[model samples]
Target: MTELARLKFYATQAHPCSYLPTEQATTLFLDPSQPMDAQVYAELSEVGFRRSGDHLYRPHCQKCSACVPARLPVADFKPNRQQRRILSRNADLQVRAVRPAFSEEYYDLYARYIEQRHADGDMYPPNREQFSTFLVRDLPFSRFYEFRLGGRLLAVAVTDVLPNGLSAVYTFYDPDEEHRSLGRFAILWQIAETARLGLHAVYLGYWIKNCRKMNYKTQYRPIELFVNQHWAILT
Candidate 1:
């Protein structure tokens, strides 16, 4: 953790917590001017920091520690019945890992998804600029993986190819195809892909036990949580 300790961090003023509205949250981010590369990013990731746009950050709230960093240990993960069924359901999706750049097709699906499913959230009424700033970064590790059906895009998993594992930054899909559970399938696929790449784990951002939207990350068995300055099994 010396690597993280030596880096400069700037804390954001306390703001309303995005996941838990009942609380206020602050974020600790790496110095914007810091020279960031894959190795540096991986070191920070190992210590629970995550990337958002050009910034690498983590929850820095004094009173609220609900946003615990979570990761799925690749070697220990095994899909359950429902996850297997989801895999079977999305067997036809042509998932392709392409460079991280904006695509009108991907944006259309993203706009529709936020409009319908996240209308009450901050990212509601999504626009091109928001999508570009949030996902399309000029980073060496950034990758945009698309899940398509018969050449029509259905979902996108914005990931980073970290040294130790893949970081699942964000995922948006066609809200119309809720039955397909593309979101769940995408995580499962990342786990398999992590194994294929001989990585250690999948860095799932944060998990809050009381937050339904965030807590679902625990569904991946043998997941590890960074708490009290250490990574430990949470299951």
Candidate 2:
């Protein structure tokens, strides 16, 4: 048997659940002082850990197990009709992978997305500080994928490159382009990028069954869910 590294973990105080309003949520995070390199992060991700800014954490709620870590096995992935249409619809957009840096245009799109689409969510009233803390951070393997059409920015996907695959940290797009389904296209692009890189999977943070906002994650077939200390294919 392989021995894992000894690491310290801390749990946050109970807070209102972000997905399910009726429940409380707690998070288990690795020690901040410890080194968090790409190798360590990849190991942690295989066991269902997720990164927010510089913190690596996972839900540790005592009363509920609604948040399930999800990942897509790239080799087995197959897009449905709707996802295919979304890809074709956004085919004209150009994608570029660049270093994660603060940009006014990206921030503007993010602010508008939060203001118009997610006013009731926690990230509403988005500001520069909050945006920087959430998406822009000092990570060697992180990248910002920019989507554009005719020189106009449409979406930005913040992704982290792990040893085994890519991790979808967050995505924000022009709310006015809702008809283009930019969010779905962003994920599809990530999937294609993962395959292009010959990676194994794409880690999609957490999927809550009861949350309407997260239901779309299940639409990607051949997805595996981390449950009861194991990853099982969800049919």
Candidate 3:
């Protein structure tokens, strides 16, 4: 069989849904023993899988189809009034894509972000190992985008470079910079960068309409959601 043909998937047992606490969730993931192939990874991405550390996974809940994979077609994206304002608001912040590495500075920013914004979530009380493993993996396609103002760190957007598009793995910013809306700014920047690089889409991972934290993804207009085995326009 071909390399792609050799792929296999396993589903985890039911557990509390991370997005909606009222539901149970399961996840489908690739075999950890299989070596990661970029082409294979890209293909899987088209169907909704995402990378977490060294593994690729997606929500596999049987009873709930609320979780829907979403991506933005960069060329067709038109920043809404609010999004354009978010971009213009943070115009002073310098942005750059650098090699992914673990630094106390990044970790400190991440720790503070989690403690303030996600203290009630699973990533509450962030530590070095969790930070390193989640975002600092040595994958060839991984990149860390640092947003700074006058050389002071404000946010870090962890992204994955894919064959056809960019995947927004995660983003964390200074809670103190709440007016900057750094998290939303990071995604807007990525969409613009993806188009500048001649890419097609920016994968924003999954969105569940009922989940307040995830529903914001719809603000990016002209979104295409992978549903019923095909990408359907959700605009």
Candidate 4:
């Protein structure tokens, strides 16, 4: 058997849904202690395993197939006028990739973002321990891209670089810097970072049709979606 096929995991339980309204779902857990190869992760990603809080999960509903893994071809990716403007607007900001670390600054930014952007969402005020477990724990490869403005922390994006591509796990920004368009800027940074690393693609997790929060991801044109286990290019 191949190395990727040897890594085994199973679905544990049916849990509450993190996205969408009136929908329920469950996550399949894997042994984080094991040394799974990058090829294993790539395969899982193609199969719709999204990295969430140190866990790789896909919507394993018997009746639904809405949550599909979406990826962007970094080589073919183009920065349109608007995306270029967003990048230009944040020209003063600098990025430094560092090993994932738990910090009060990160937690503070996360709380502010959650409260402001997703006030009614379930992940409000996540404590330090929970935040560490969720963001920094149990992953083989993880990093944080710190966005600094005048040497001040304005945003931090946590990501994982898998074999096939980079997966954007999560991002939080200083709510006070609303004018900077931190959320959109962060994604543009990811695309540039992927290109810099010579990576082929950047996985953008899921894009639900009706979720406005997710709809914006579609703006990153020329994204390919996994439909029925095939990568379908979106027009």
Best-to-worst order by TM-score is 2, 1, 3, 4
Stretches of candidate 1 exceeding 4 Å from the true structure:
none
Query: If both were scored by lDDT, which would come out higher, candidate 2 or candidate 4?
Result: 2
TM-score, cand. 2 vs. native: 0.97
- Pick out the ten consecutive residues of candidate 4 with the lowest summed lDDT: 1-10
Instruction: Find the 10 residues in a row with the least total lDDT in model 2.
Output: 1-10
| lDDT of the candidates, in the order given | 0.91, 0.92, 0.91, 0.80
Residue-wise lDDT of candidate 3 within 1-235, one digit each (tens)?
1365668999999999888888999999999987776777788888899999999999998899998999999998899899989999999999988989999999999999999999989988899999998889888898999999988999999999888799999999999999988989999999999999998899999988888899778988899999999999995
Per-residue lDDT of 61-176 in model 4, one digit per residue for the tens? 66566677788888888889988888999999989988887778888888778888878777775667767877875456778989998889999988888777888888889989
Candidate 2 residue pairs in clash (backbone atoms < 3 Å): none
lDDT of 2 by residue, 1-235 (tens): 1124687889999999888999999999989997768888888998899999999999999989999999999999999999999999999999998898898998999999999999999998999999999999968999999999988999999999988999999999999998999999999999999999999999999999889999999999899999989999998
| TM-score of every prediction relative to native | 0.97, 0.97, 0.96, 0.92
TM-score of 4: 0.92
Candidate 1's residue-wise lDDT over 1-235, tens digit each?
2465687889999999999989999999999999767888888887789999999999999998888899998998889999999999999889899888888988899999899989989998799999999998878889999999998899999999988999999999999999999889999999999999999999999999898888679888999999888899985
Ranked by lDDT, top first:
2, 3, 1, 4
Evaluated against the true structure, the overall lDDT of model 3 is 0.91
- Give the CA lDDT, 0 to 100, for residue 30 in model 4: 61
